[model samples]
Target chain A: MSMQDTASSGVALWRLVADGIERGIADGRFAAGDKLPGEMEIAETYRVNRHTVRRALAALAERGIVRAERGSGTYVEAQKLAYPLRSRTRFSEIVGAEGREPHGRMIEASEDVATRELARELGLKTGAPLVRIEAIRLADRTPICVSTTWLSAELFPGAGTVFAATRSMTKMLEHYGIRDYRRGATRITAGIVDATDAARLDLPLGRPILVVDATDLDLEGKPLVTKHSRFAAERVEFLVEP
Target chain B: MSMQDTASSGVALWRLVADGIERGIADGRFAAGDKLPGEMEIAETYRVNRHTVRRALAALAERGIVRAERGSGTYVEAQKLAYPLRSRTRFSEIVGAEGREPHGRMIEASEDVATRELARELGLKTGAPLVRIEAIRLADRTPICVSTTWLSAELFPGAGTVFAATRSMTKMLEHYGIRDYRRGATRITAGIVDATDAARLDLPLGRPILVVDATDLDLEGKPLVTKHSRFAAERVEFLVEP
Candidate 1:
């Protein structure tokens, strides 16, 4: 099961080393944005020469598993957090399972009239007042997602105050006497990060972001909230289970 | 409801125009990479002035929904094709459901010994012979995905030939007496396109690509084939339905 064990096969030593490093990445031995070990260290670990380690690093770079800076050592490209979308999915639990601390910061919150699209999504009439909560979510202090969530203002009158106080959606919903909600439909698209999101996410311009348009429903199947989330694409991977 | 009908609401006219145009993009009235009509035309359609239309377009540009090309008007940024990843998802059917033609081309097909990663994915011993199929898929002649698939060579011999003849994975499986197969786990990540895929997908360098690592399972719940597909992130979206 080790990368070195596969070297006995006909595959090149460099490839095996590269594959091993990649496996390390996939399994989280090497975190994204973390500087890779020095070439001498890798060579020693793999029982290979520095030249072979160099070749392996090059291959990894070509595949975008890692990137090399002119002066800095090689670093894993981005975090690939396993994010699962399920009925009872909880953001805090998901990040916790990955051994990372999850933090949410409220950027802005307001009560506004729902736009036509928002009304249709939340099953509210046009011009109905809604509470809009904008927040940035971070995994272990690394900003990863910026989301805007809208709920019926009439139903969740103090939603903004609750969210700002708790910094947790699930907790905020609990304060509304609703303890159970499930994911409805999730639509995942991608786009280049806009300026505002780039600043919020601390991502460079032109980086791709995964746009998630999702709905949450209460125990009675009534739409509870409509959320628009933009995830730093490189930092997370969605795991879809049947 | 039409965008013009929403004008009666308190929202500004320019904002209404922008929302309408965005809706048009979402509903496929305008496709990815398609240039927008002239300002005069858009104004006429929305019953607005040229200045109002210009402001709307600018808003769209700021949101990354569309990009303005110098002297050539504005263009819809990219197509957002809805791709559902289900127990029985098919590429051609998904594309066709979106009112676009689906085409597949075999870039290369060969018999190769499975590497460690490939062996683990296909549940085979390292060095086991396997058939590798590399293909590019398109929607209405717009390249969208490039995938590499691996099957146990001993179990399904000449899979490449069947695939070349049918241009369909479902059909290829049929030739191997697999009347039905379902999707297993799917991992979705995003990265910038490399040079080879950029050319194959007719995309510019640095554009984001969705990396989908998936498995096909036979009726008996055995792994059949493993697929690695890279999609033009802007052209397609994955719909995960509960």
Candidate 2:
């Protein structure tokens, strides 16, 4: 129906188009991971302009019901993977249990001096050497998060090299004779993705990202490493455990 | 002096502007909660065009270092409020502890039927009567979150009316003889604000919001109410307490 036909129904025309697509997904007319019809096709089916269909699709993408790939058509989003926050959380273990292959690629590594805040957080002196590493984490070839991790360079000498070689922070720590660590504190916020992280996470610029700042403590309750992770919000949900 | 001068230094012009502003904030040249200079003023100070200044400001806003007010100038953001996701989370208490006034205004409320998912979540029969309430929560007159809450209408008759009059969900629960409740499961995601919620939250469109889906349980471990709260990400940070 045209805008005038649906205008009297008290709902906006774009909303109606969105609701129609939602119903189609609910009724199995559009299956999970299925590519949605082209915007022109949807416009024709709904008897609306392409603009209306585009708005409807944007709404769906915002709701995480579908995702638009660069230069590719939109597809219905699969079920969101649950990422749990708990003591001793392991990314590889979590994704493995979910039947997804987890991969972490080291983007870069640098050795720097800790600022006052970093020194206090890591229980080290100011100007202490620190190893910072950035990596992109993926599950089953789908980019999930971009994480930056920081550790005391003196404590874990050559950590950047180790992490780059193993692509596993846990393995890097193990080489330093630390086999276990527990979560200390986690602070979560949300923000629009910047250009660099958007490309690294394979998300559209301006998409929401869950910013997680966390610290891992050794078994003795000493800070081991601090991490800043930006997760693609549509692809995952964070479960906070009591 | 301009893009050409900054380009040779290996940093984008917009990035230099952003860093200058950030340094201003750090050195107390631009104090928190202080209104920043207008875009034109900033451009003149940085010897760049207004578009470059605008891009720099957008970057700062994305980083939560600044916030733009509609039709007003940008301001350096104050320290973010820490929202702890504990078993007993009281909004008023949290805000009061932060030395800010807390208010909840009911936008709308209605009686409805629980869908299958809602019924499953609330441990009620499908199509059971439900009461849905929408409210905008504020701290010191700044909109923090827009919450949609659902309760079993059969269990708490006239809950919406009670909440509308009291403006406190805790008081409404007290009216229903629920003296105590604890948090159950909490799920967090992030998404761009929709038109309606952006208005309700006084946020710019496309701003990131933290979507928190939480269930409150009675002392007996039965679900009492399920809440979907969208918090303005720039104004608050969620702390996961151990």
- Give the candidate number with the greatest TM-score: 2
Task: Estimate, for each residue in A1-242, the C-alpha lDDT of model 2 and write its tens digit.
Answer: 66454312223567557756764664357889999988889999878899988887887787688898867898986556689888878889989988999999999999989877778878999899999999999999889999989899888888988998988988989989998989987899887666578779876444568989888999899999988899998788899765
What's the C-alpha lDDT at position A176 in model 1? 88
Angstrom error of the Cα, residue B125, model 2: value is 1.5
* lDDT (C-alpha) at residue A183 in model 1: 91
Worst 10 residues of 1 chain A by lDDT: A1-10
Q: How would you encode candidate 1's per-residue C-alpha lDDT over A96-194 as one tens digit per residue?
A: 999999999999999899878889889999999999999999999888799999999999998999999999999999998988999988888776665
Top candidate by lDDT: 2
Best candidate, DockQ: 2
Full-model lDDT for every candidate: 0.81, 0.82
lDDT of 1: 0.81
**Candidate 1, superposed: residue stretches over 4 Å from native:** A1-79, B1-79
Report the lDDT of model 1 for residue A62.
65
TM-score of chain B of each: 0.71, 0.76
User: Per-residue lDDT of B10-51 in model 1, one digit per residue for the tens?
Assistant: 134565577568757865778889888998899998778888
